[model samples]
Target: MKKRFWIAIPIMAFGLGWPLLAQENPTEPQPQHAQAQAQPAVSAPDVKSPGTPQLDAADLEAWLDGYMSGALEQGDVAGAVVSVVKDGRPLFAKGYGYRDVASKLPMDAAQTLVRIGSTSKLFTWTAVMQLVEQGKLDLDADVNTYLDFTIPERDGGPVTMNDLMTHRGGFEEGLKEILITDPAKFITTEKYLKDHMRPRIFPVGKVPAYSNYGTALAGYIVERLSGEPFDDYIERHILGPLHMERSTFRQPLPEKFQDNVSLGYMSASQPPQAFEMITSAPAGSMSATADDMANFMIAHLQQGRFGDARILKAETARLMYQPSAPHEPGFTTMAHGFFSGPINGKRLIGHGGDTIWFHTDMNLIPEEGVGFFVSFNSRGKNEAVYGMRERFVEGFMDRYFPDKGNEPLPPAIQSAQADAQALAGKYRSSRRIDTAFLKLIYTLQQSTVIANEDGTISFASEPGTKYRETAPGMWRDPNSEGALHVSTVDGQLTITNSKNPVSDMQRVPLAESAGLNSFILFGSIAVILLALVAWPLSWWCRRLYGQTLGLTGRDLVAYRLSRLLMVGDMIYLLGWYMALQPLFQMQFDGFGTALDPLLFTLQAGALVPLIGVGVGLWNAWLTVRSDRHVMAKAGSVLFAAALCGVAWVAFIGGLMSFTLEY
Candidate 1:
């Protein structure tokens, strides 16, 4: 039920026939050493000029500031700083709201230090690209050859550097806890390979799985080949060249800098917690100011040039922007980045970052020679970030690329009732293991089902049945279908079928607990059938034969049933123990013999009651057949006591709480 919402913005220029304007003044004077300068000296835009450019600057600043204010008011951010540049020049830069609510400290453009999160990956990529240009490292070479230790093979083939860079390595599928708590236990790229060598989720280069571990490995490889620590190498090569003095990779804040760093907030309920410096620093652990990030974006916008200093050859910069693989249609995937896509019709490139307590976005409109960077110091609604970015982008394009017309909006959903009714239906799909085990069907209703599909569907008020589309060709019946299992790949739909042989079934009639109800019904039927068969057999035998001889059948049947039930109980106990084994082992003074009491209680407690119940019933049958009133009464009392004891013990031990509904 926990869904991570990622705002995927199409970096295409809005509106058709929009004219792209270049920001760099052709008639402006230039210094003799400008071409050789490594960092550009930034200055505020000249707003007093009587020209179209001046009007554009005012519109751009107002648009950006308005969105920032709206975002803060919506409780989607504690504070934010935004910087916009045109042709490697600072057009507008400002900060809004309190960085630390408890201290009542307002964020300022010069002082605020925002965590850029995965935007740090761009610097790492730039460093690696520098190495590639120097001919010191090969992108396609086997990465294990340069590692301090050996990288184990997956199905006898080593994962290449390209695989790591593109996230094609197959070691990303396991549980993250194995690495989160004690990273050193699985730190090295070589150790990770050795541990997960033979297991592969997908074939190399077949699919792109966004992997944090794989990126970390790439960082390690960069460090090893350069004979320097990863952070040190980046600081020396990339940051130093760009003159990003305040930027650092997980460095402890100095007393002077502490006041400058933003206090990142999550939801309003709890106070903000200090962000942890991750061991996997390469993926997303760098911190910087809006000015520093704006400079970085300017470098990219100018095609690897900052003022006169060229960090990379123009050809190399072009290669970085070139499509590395197929992404969504009309969009292209760059080297670990996103490139331009068809929106209205213009070209744009950008990336968004979401780390704990922060959301950031960096975008560049190359044709217009305009770029922008926005960072929020809060874990707020992702939709707010996306909406703000879209509005800013749209306003900028209208000013700079006015020739392009506005993009057409998709048709809106008018009637909720009509929409819900059209989406209800039966859906099915096969599982990887068993094709027949996965057929799923759902009955639908408006109150019972919440439609998750994008398109319109009809809804019925009475007996409330509605149809909801999860994807094209996939629909869920609101009356019968509870939670429909659906997947979308490039707008194509795949629905899970529960009736299939290998399926993991989903509940229909959305509000009902179908699986738990089925289990209870099956258990009740089994208990009744056992008693029914035992009672009839016991009576027939006593009537035809003597009491002692006739009781053998009942005794044998009871013995088998008790053993079966006890085995089932033991299996359940073992599973529970294994799940909590990590916690027990982690606790103080608990060693190998710690689980003994738990094991014994489950075994003895479950077995004794079932055995006692069977014995008492058998004895009562014999007494009744012999016309012994006293013996029959005693047997009945014993049976009642055993049942009561079983229920009492189960309740006290917290087992009965499992059956209770929330």
Candidate 2:
């Protein structure tokens, strides 16, 4: 669901007999000349003839080989395997580079077992669709009926299967909060639903927020209805039927196939870490070879038939290719699993996958009966894979609709220095109240630019430690993309694209500011301490102050602590607000700045009662403390809570040092 640059053939053109249109003439094309330009028209060639105008076999091989080699040269990949199939026949299948760089082992086509990432979701969806075809599940039925746990509804209506498939289930983005931390714990669809039964972020069946949890839930539904494990069901129903013997939910690299496996490598900044299998297998924990993937693509292109065997009915496959939801403009359609889009007017369905150490792409042109799969074992920002797909599609289109040759490159337009400077002014979005600073930062340590770019930028922080820009105005320190934005306005810098106008961009001297450090250190320590102590204090407060507080000591403690914590949180929030305020008129409220330490301390204090209640309750249950020994119980709780809070705060503070701005 994370949007990436996509390259696929058109579905409408490929399906239902839509005539292919030639690429727009480059000499007289559209106004936008930011990136790629359109190609010129070519005459169509006869498809029935065996010999036609297409990339020569030798040239095609060289192109693919050059692509793989270039990827390695650019340090975007350590090794890779590529496979091209046309008309259900293997045009070429080969591997390039080393599988084990340290051991100096060569990679082979048959042995690669790379983490295919979210592409695994396609297989999961395929299995679910197969079940749908079997009359085992209904897309419109309430998913909660099959779930073992309650799925909280939005507006008192349970989410349906269709919502899950289309990612319109109204579930919050649960990956960072739930999945990444401990996926297995939330494995059961029922448990996941129960834990996340809050109101929808957007109306169901409206906006689509890509959710791995939603797809994982669908996988679970398959398991429950099929009476088989999610992985086994796919293997038996889909993979097995397609004769994809090497593909598996588990690591596909066995000893026999180890020789051919490509060694996945991260950039030197992000050295290869030991691979840990994700417990959320359905979302992105599977491995397969180019040979196996080619077969799968071929089956889809052939209307769900592999040779004489029909893996899925043609009508069902057609439904899978139908547009299920509206995507951002330029995107063809987001079908059940595949993305339906255009490539020179030819319909194409495909998906791309990016994991820790791999990038993959698969595209199929059903009308031309051609498909290709390419995977890289390293990660970088070069758009070669996408470019390769475009070229391949161009070749295909030229063969089928020869009149549509490669589009001419757009005329280069150099922005005048004065104009460029004029456009350099700080600009901010009018949608939000946050401001992201985008300027060059010169510190005693190093000089760096925070300039906002259209695409990703990487920072080499330390050896094997890299930061990648995951979103506009935001960079991911290590792996996952964090939500952050930056904008420019009249040469002034603002952080988030807040609606509020920012003052002037005043440079802050980078030094050890006590207030900033305290906010960083104490704010974190207090939050952790409070979080640790709040619950326990709630219980003890229920017993001690419950009668006096007009509620259980626990309830009173929870309520009071929550309120105070909320206040402290508000102070910090206000400080951030002031920091983003317009410079000229900005006034850091004395009260807000002054209360920083107090708020921190109060946050720590609130934890005391909470911890006291926890220890008291635990000790009382275990008979470790007598009723007369309330003070001792409270002390014990305080000690334990303080230790946990300190430890947690330390960890969080370390993380903040790399991520947060003072």
Candidates in order, TM-scores: namely 0.58, 0.54
Give per-residue CA lDDT, model 1, range 284-304, as digits (tens).
567877767766777777778
Deviation in Å, model 1, residue 183 alpha carbon: 13
The residue ranges of model 2 lying beyond 4 angstroms of the native Cα positions read 1-57, 176-199, 251-261, 268-271, 327-330, 380-662
lDDT at 484 for candidate 2?
23
Over 1-662, each residue of candidate 2 has an lDDT whose tens digit, in order, gives 11122321110000000000112223421212111112111223325445454644565676666655665656544566667666555566677766566765555555455666667777888887888899988888898888887665566366887777666676543321122223233234444444444335445665444555676788888889999977778888877766676677753234554444455565422345344244446766667777678778767776777765667898998898787764433345567766666554456677666544555667777766677777666543343434433344454445544433334322212432222233232221111111111011111112122322432322222223222333333333332111123344233343321111111122222332223333444554464456556756766877886543343555445445544443444344344334334222212122223334533443344344344334434533432333435754454454344333333332322211221111
Q: What lDDT would each prediction earn against the true structure?
A: 0.49, 0.49
On the 0 to 100 scale, the lDDT of residue 298 in model 1 is 76
Error of 2 at 548 (Å): 47
Looking at model 1, which ten-residue stretch has the lowest summed lDDT? 11-20
Model number with the top TM-score: 1
